[model samples]
Structure formats: structure tokens, C-alpha cells
Target: MRILVTGGAGFIGGHLAERFVIDGHDVVVLDNFDPFYDTRIKAHTVERCRERAAGGDGSYRLVEGDVRDADVVAELVEEVDYVYHQAAQAGVRPSVEDPRKYDDVNVDGTLNVLDAARDTGIERVVLASSSSVYGKPRYLPYDEDHPTTPVSPYGASKLAAERYACSYSEVYDLPAVALRYFTVYGPRMRPNMAISNFVSRCLDAESPVVYGDGTQTRDFTYVEDVVEANVTLLAEDAADGEAVNVGSTDNIEIRTLAEEIRDQLAPDLTLEYEERHDADADHTHADISKANDLIGYEPTTTIREGVWKFTEWYRNDRDWYEPLVLNS
Candidate 1:
């Protein structure tokens, strides 16, 4: 099958693209290579995907463009058998500072993708949503039926995108599935995220900063599991027009996560705690029963295993991963 992966140069998107290539599917990656993080990392991601494709029966192509470009989205949608929409202005805190950019890229860009898919008769679209849409979670282990009261602009935009996907599916009979991802972490993770930041800081023998006493909990899903969910939904007929959670059922406190990283990399480093960001959720856990039922999705990586893998990559493999230093 010919697959189009939006934001395919980022962590999850890059891994997903490589998997599709190894599975003998032709893949086209669309990314604007936004400067939110370094574009060099994304370049490396594309290079790795191309290398993987070289040994397989599949081919890979990179189309440098923004999802907001309707013409580009339509043209890509018309050519691909399936669309994996992963492009967005990620991060809750950053979105709080620049809500309009989030709205423009996450919401309007998603509408463009869905509209293009609908117009071109694309078979299926797998959207990358977020657990943040559930806000503080009125109930533990948020299910698909849970109300979406997002606390952050990023979450709100993601919710809006998911709603648009559902609406497209209902009104135009488009086959679209929105997968609400939890706190995904692994090698090639964005440097701004908690796990990545902690791991990098620990490796450098620098004290990592934690917010809100480090009591906040998150169901940290591995990138491979997240990619597998998207791949599974691509062919799942029953998942059409449905939103499902893609996450590990395991939830861990932020303090525990920092401790784990410290134990592995910097045993003597002490963590510094600060006030939590207003847009940040206190806790998040996903009920992935719907994903299991529809697409046989199950998270295979434990937090310890995932963190170890990421550390290994950072130390021995990821020569390009430079630790980002942020002002406190």
C-alpha cells in the first residue's frame, strides 16, 4: 500500500514511516520541518527512513510542505492509500504562550487534511490526538466516552481536530480514526518533553527540574506501541469514525520517572521541583480497551524498558541528539 504520513520527520512519525517501509509499503512523508525543535533531527529521521527503505521492497519520499497547504494535502491524499495525520504544534506549555499558532496548525491544518481526504476519496485516515483532551480526567483511565474538557490550548486544538475527523466521517462517509496518544517516550523524542528532558539532564550530570512536586502522573506509552496502533487502524474497518486511546495502562508519577532516569544515568543528581504550569494536567491514564477491541492494540514496552532503550540510543547511537539547555 502507498501511505502518506504527515509530520513523518518527527519522532513518532519517523518511526511509523520506517515501520511501514520495512513492511514493504511505499511511504511518502510530509513535513514542514518547523523550527520548534531543530530541523537537523528531522533530517536525520528522514535519512534513517530512507536507509530502512533501501533494504526493503518499499520506497520512501519526503515532501517538504506544511499541512496548512490545502493544495499540497489534497494532492498527497489523492495519491496515497491511507493518511496518518501526525503533524501539529505539540506541547501544552508552549501552546499556552502561542495559542494562535496552535490553532492555525493543529485545528485549521487538520480540517484541511480531513477535507482533502474527504474530497479525494481516501480509504482511511488515522489522526494523532492527545490524552490532554480529557483535562484533569473526571474519571481515572479515561475512556472514549469521557467528556473532553481540555485545559490547554494544545489540548483544545487536538479535540477540535478529532471532532472534525468524526464529523467528516459521519457527514461524508469518510473512514477516519482518531487515536488519543498518552505521554509517548522513546529514542528520538522531542527534547522539550519531560522524559527526554530528564534523561538528557541526568546523562549530562545536571539536575533535572520537575514541576508541581513531581506528583503528576502520566500513562507513558512507548513510541513503537503508538506506531503499531496507527498501523493497525489503517486496515481496521470497525475503527472508522471512532476515537481510541493508544497508551500503556501503566501510570507513573513524574517524580518516580525522574528518579528512574537519575538512577540509570546520574545516581547522585537531585531533582529540583517548581510550580506546575497552568495548562498541564495533574494526571492522565488511558483506557485502551476500545483500541484492543477494534485493532488488537496492546502496549508492549514497560516504562523501565522504554527508558533504558532511550538512554542507550542517546548514549551510543544518537550522535545527533544534542541536549537542549533551557533557562529556568
Candidate 2:
């Protein structure tokens, strides 16, 4: 299989790209190396993909380009069997500062990808949506049927992108599946994420900042589990034109999660509580039954296990960390 993964150099996308390559599928990664966090991390991800592909029967190609470019997206879509549209301007807080950039990339860029997929004869497109689209959930474990009342520009952009994908699926007969991923964390996590920030701070003996009262919870899905859900969708046809939630189904309080990380990485360090951002959701719990029914997706990583694994990686992988001063 020939697969195109946009934003393939990012955390989740990188994992998916490497997994596909290891499974003996030709993979093409298109990433602009967006300066959201650090481009070096993305570059390292691409290098890892190259290393994995070197030993497998599959091949990997990295194309440094933006997804917002219609010509680039169309040209790449023409050569792949499946398109995993993972490119976007991520981060809720950052999006709050600059909403137009998020719209241009997440909404308009998604349209470009879908339009190209439609123009070409690509049947399946897997879009990366977010649980943020649900806002403060009226009910626990948000399902696909939950109302989409995005509280942030990031969430709004994702909702718009998912709508565009579904619209293309309906109007052009292009099969599209939008996977609303919960808070994902694991190896190669971006520095801006809570888990990564907490872990990094703990390692540096710095007090990890806890936003809000810390009672707010999140359904933290491991990166490997997310990759599994995405890979399963490639072989699934029943989920076309539908939105599904990809999560671990294990919701944990932010404070609890921070304590776990601190205890595991720095037993002596304490966490500092701070006011939460206004755009932050009080909670995010995904009802992943739809994903299970559609793709037989089941999460296998617990919070403790995921944190341990990430801490282990962080301790051993010094190359990716050397560029940034942890305590500074």
C-alpha cells in the first residue's frame, strides 16, 4: 500500500508513518515542519522513519511542504492509495492568540486535501479531528452524537475541518473517516503538551505547573493506541463518512496525572497550581464505542504505564533533548 501522511513528522503522525513502514507499506510523509514547538524534533522523527524503512521491505519519502498549498496536496494525493490528513496548526492556547492561522491551516488546508482527494480517485481519507470539538461536555464520555460547541478557535477549526471532510464524502462519494483523538501522549510528544511539560519539569527538579484547581480530567490516549486506531481504519470500509472517537477510555484528573509523573520522575518535586486558561475545557472523556464498533479499536495503555514508558524514553533519548535547556 502507498500511504500519504500529512504532518507525518509530528508525534502522532510520526508514529503512524513509522508503523506503516514497519508493516511493509510504502509511506510518503508530507510535513512543513511547522515551528509550533521545535522543528528539530520533527526532523528527528523523519530520521527515525528513514531508519525504520531502511531495514523493511517498504520505502519512506519525506516531502517538506505545507498542506495549505493546493498544488502540493493535489500532486501528492495523486500518487497515494490512502491519505491520512494529519496536518494542522495545533494547540488551544496558541490558537487563541492567533485564530486565523488555525483556520487557514486546519479548515482551509483540510478543504484542500479533500478537494485533491476528490479530484484524484482516492476513495479513503482519514482525518485527524479533536475531542475539543465537544467543548465542556454536557455528558460524560462524549460520543459522536454529542453536540459540537467548541470553546476555542482550535476546536472550532477542527469542527470545521471534520465538516468539510464529511461534506466531500457526501457530495463527491469520497469515503472519509474523521477520528476525534483525545489527549494523546507518549514518546516524541510535543513540548507544549501538559504531559510533556510536566515530565520535563519534573526531570529538571522544577515544580510542574498545574492549571486550574487540577480537578479537571482528560481521557489521555497513548500514541501507540492512537496509531493502532488509525491503522485499523485503513482496512475498514464500514466507518466511511462517520466521525469516531479514539481514546483510552481511561479518564484521569490532571492533578493526579501530574503527581504520577512527579513521583515517577522526581520523587521530591512538588506541583504548582495555577489558574487555568479560559479556553481550556473542564474535562474531555471520549466514548470510543463507535471506534470499536467500526474498527475493532481497543486501547491497551494505562496512565501509569504510559507515563513510565514516556519517562523511560525521555531519560534515554538525550539527542532530542540536548537542543533545549530543561531548567532554563
Q: Write the per-residue lDDT of candidate 1 for residues 1-328, one digit (tens) a residue.
A: 9999999999889999999999999999999999888777788889989999998899999999999999999999999989999999998999989999999999999998998888876889999999989987889989999999999999999999999998899999999999999999887777778887887788778998899999889899999889888878667788898888999999999999999889878899999988887888989998989889889998999888888887787777545675442321
Predicted structure 1: clash tally = 0
The local distance difference test score of each candidate is 0.89, 0.90
The RMSD (Cα, Å) of candidate 1 is 1.5
Question: Which digits, one per residue and each the tens of the lDDT, describe model 2 over residues 1-328?
Answer: 9999999999899999999999999999999987777777888898899999999898999999999999999999999999999999999988999999999999999999998999887859999999999997889989999999999999999999998898888889999999999999988887777887888888778888999989999999999999998888778898899889999889999999999888877889878998889999999998889888878989999988998888888888855663443422
Where is model 1 more than 4 Å wrong at Cα?
Answer: 324-328
- Please provide TM-scores, in order, for all candidate models, with all chains considered together: 0.96, 0.97
Highest-scoring model, lDDT: 2
> RMSD to native for every prediction?
1.5, 1.4
